[model samples]
Target: MTDSSSNTQETDSSQYSVLNVNDWSENWQAGKIGFHKDIEHPLLVKYADKLTGGKSAQKILIPLCGKSMDIKWIADQGHTVVGVEAVEQAVLEFFTEQNIEYSKETLTDIPGDVYKSSDGRISVYRCDVFDFNRSYKDKFDAVYDRAALVAINRDDRERYATLMKSLSAPGSRMVIVTVNYDPALHPGPPHYVEEELIPKLYGNRYNVEILERSDSLEERWREKGLTYFDEVVHFLSDKS
Candidate 1:
């Protein structure tokens, strides 16, 4: 007896696949995503003023750009929007949901595809954010960081800041919105991003502005069993 039952269980475990980056990519290929937001986030709406003042048609970069509606809102204002997402399925669904026909192409520097509209009005790079440094240095005029900062474990945040700084130009502007919480109870991608740390990382190269901070997050959070969260918004500009 070759333990056939045990072999069958192992095969079944493999049947559901794994959640590695590639598995996440295949999930996009299969169109299964639940992390996407159906509407443009309120943070974008409430703080639009902090993000708006600039040359017309500025190129904006959105990192870890899940299928958020912010891309359409920004692009509709005549600005070019470029987003980088690690999940290929989310990238494909974003274009499909928007009803914008696009062509798929590979990024020369990273193992990912580019989904671009025919007119180049909107484009999203399906790749890891870290890979952009080699090909995308000084490429964006502004960066909109929503959820990207908190979505990763805190161990990598410093690297995240460094990569973001590298991709932006001198005098570039970025709006970073993150929520704060206690790590002891609320293990996160809801990870606690302390407000005092921006200057420690980017202060040498950028001017940091504390645009807004409040404890009045939406009421739904408390119901989710997280009792504490502080909404924080920052306006970052390169001082060069």
Candidate 2:
């Protein structure tokens, strides 16, 4: 899943149901990914230093990554990049499109496979993000969450946030991009995440900072009758 740039028309909240793995695969197969961007997200480019700290070889994690070009961009910085995506098609497309040679291995502990770049700088776990857990505790030095949080079911956000915490090392950092819009206008995979919710979710362990908030309502959202939309970026650091 990408951001709020969905090609489908907005519908009533009741018409939208929480999507499952098969549903996501169907979306990919049907080419319904207007949310996917051809270029790396600008916010990620602008605020990358917050995560990388100008250091090389940092271990970075991307959850719910959908063949994002940012994966390659981050790896090119001489860091190790790990991404978790549930769709096999998306994962395959990433390696093929990027022209990166890779090897795939079936994971012993999980139901999915891991795809690793020939250079060993990038690895993508093809599995449900929730199933990826503490076996890799304190593994990541930083995380780039461009669309992961906003793409999940609202009911699963707490679990998702907890998982993020567990996967990160002490003093780790994260950058997240979220969207806010009237749910009544468009119930979403890119759901309305209130600004207040971030601190509530991670305040206990991480220092939270709002990096940017912009009026990012695209023409499609405006046409869907959304009076306003705000795209927000947040930086979070573990209070170690």
Candidate 3:
């Protein structure tokens, strides 16, 4: 399966059928992750300070986190990392591939199990994002969303943001990476999230700032019928 920050060669869009949300687990199980990246996202390194908001130690939440290497990078930075993934195999691959010793526990309260590093610095919950309970809201001090929103259908984008808000602490901040493109050109797993929509989604609770924009991905994804492929980075924090 592709990591959220897939750095591999881009596949022709016509080569595959549109991804169905219900088939996410199947996709992972089948190793259909052309989107996966072996390294941390450049933006995560570039805007670390802003995401952390000068806080030295934080509990960061990652939604739909596949076995991306960024989770370890975040943990290496002295912050506790909590990730949510729907596939158990993905979670296992993360720990096994990273050589991190971890223990798994079934959560009686939730539909899935919790896997944590031996040091307790990182935890990943294996469950559907919607199955995630609201009682745990306001637990994370920061959030890192890379391609998660784009991976979902348009109908679920707003619902995704609402869940993220619930997980954020009062003064939490986030670094969200999205692609800005003409949606009418190509349907996407890396969907087009127009700049205007960011405000409508997160602006009600936090101040949103556009940190950077680049068309570097046009070369890789142009075959997908994109006239322009912009990688937009945003920093969001509570209004308070």
In model 2, how large is the Cα lDDT of residue 83? 96
Q: What are the per-residue Cα lDDT tens digits for candidate 2 across 150-239?
A: 988877899999898888888899998999887766767787788988998899999999999978878878889988988899999889
Flag regions of model 1 displaced more than 4 Å.
Answer: 1-35, 214-220
Question: Per-prediction count of colliding residue pairs?
Answer: 1, 0, 9
Ranking by TM-score: 2, 3, 1
Q: Estimate each model's TM-score.
A: 0.81, 0.90, 0.87
Worst 10 residues of 1 by lDDT: 9-18
**Tens digits of per-residue lDDT for model 1, 1-240:** 122233222221121111235545655666554445688877787866556555678888999888889988888878899998888768877888988889998778767788898778788888877776665655788889987876654556799888888788777888888777654434444456677787787788878888777784445556557677786888887887
Q: Which window of ten consecutive residues has the lowest lDDT sum in model 2?
A: 1-10
| Ten contiguous residues minimizing lDDT sum, candidate 3 | 8-17
Pairs that collide, model 1? 28-89
Candidates 1 and 2 compared by lDDT, better number: 2
lDDT of 3: 0.81
C-alpha local distance difference test of each model: 0.73, 0.86, 0.81
